[model samples]
Target: MATAIGMVELTSIARGIETCDYMVKAAQVDLLRSSTVCPGKYMIIVGGETGDVRAAMAEGIKRGGELVVDTLMLPNVHEQLIPAISMTNQVDVRGAVGVLEFYSIASAIIAADVAAKAANITLIEVRTGYAIGGKGFVTLTGDVGAVRAAVEAARKDAELLVETTVIPRPDKKLFDALL
Candidate 1:
């Protein structure tokens, strides 16, 4: 089976979430919205089927323009799928799913809690850290897909609220060790 992946770089984190909600409802597709906001930029990823995927990307552009986005980024649309467990499957997954780095502990906790709720995980352990300066990191665990979603949600939640960086775990060692 082929799945369409649509990635839209938006002007603001809030607008990105709004655009995603609009696209999801308009296309009537079961989709997930994840965002990462760096300094002066926001990148949002919305994935689903090809046809609707394209349309959703278009909607994002439209919304961004209407919102007077200072920088309207070109939407990147693609199609890809992997043989992974669905969110419905109750599998005890263990690994470093995703980590959202924040500038403050308050922001980190806020993002972590939001991600946990979105992912439907009860026991979410949020680790706070200051690598060198006063940067904080929030790590969420649980089902693979859920953890990914949670991380994205956390990023979106923290974008404007604080200065942060969201990092998804491509390697599972660190997360596995913690477990």
Candidate 2:
């Protein structure tokens, strides 16, 4: 069930994976066949010996972090991200920590959106408000765990581009106010 065959020759097989209907047919033969979902974007398939695959996976995760920052502008903005939890019967979380950049609402919103999806949450809404330092904040909401994970993923994704901090849900009053 391995996705990749060991020591594949760099010929038609690699090229076929890049552009060929047979790639899909081959997948039908085995769903585990190593394939890149979004080549050159968030995903890439680099094949070699078993050891190479291991290193590639690690590098992929690392590169993903780099992509997150490139896509989300972190510098020149006061950014603070946290999970927003709901106290309703669903007990669901529906937003992410506000991502601020250059005090530009649009950029902050984009960061929040990218962070939200990376964390696997539905972006319910994006709201802007004042931070403690008079800096602007863009708050996003979605599933609780997704929001938490997204924040983490966003940080990892932007590891090279920016530094980030995680803020857990605050007091009941504040949570209620945001909801």
- For each candidate in turn, the TM-score is 0.38, 0.32
Alpha-carbon local distance difference test for all models: 0.48, 0.34
Predict model 2's lDDT versus the native.
Answer: 0.34
**Model 2 compared with the native: what TM-score?**
0.32
Best-fitting candidate, scored by lDDT: 1
Enumerate residue pairs that collide in model 1: none
Instruction: Give RMSD to native, each candidate.
Output: 12.0, 14.5
- Report the C-alpha lDDT of model 2 over 1-179, residue by residue, as the tens digit: 22221111112224424422322223222112222222221112232233434444443334343332122212221112222211122226534443323232223344554575565554323332223221123344455566667656544533222334333555566656655
In model 1, the runs with Cα more than 4 Å from the true position are 66-179
lDDT of 1 by residue, 1-179 (tens): 24555545555667767776776766644554344444434444445566766777677777766542332112222111110101222226554456666664335545654665577532324333223233345544565666667666767747434433323454556544534
lDDT score at residue 7, model 2, on the 0-100 scale: 12
Q: How many backbone clashes does candidate 1 have?
A: 0
The list of candidate 2 runs beyond 4 A from truth reads 1-102, 122-125, 128-136, 141-145, 155-165
Error of 1 at 97 (Å): 14
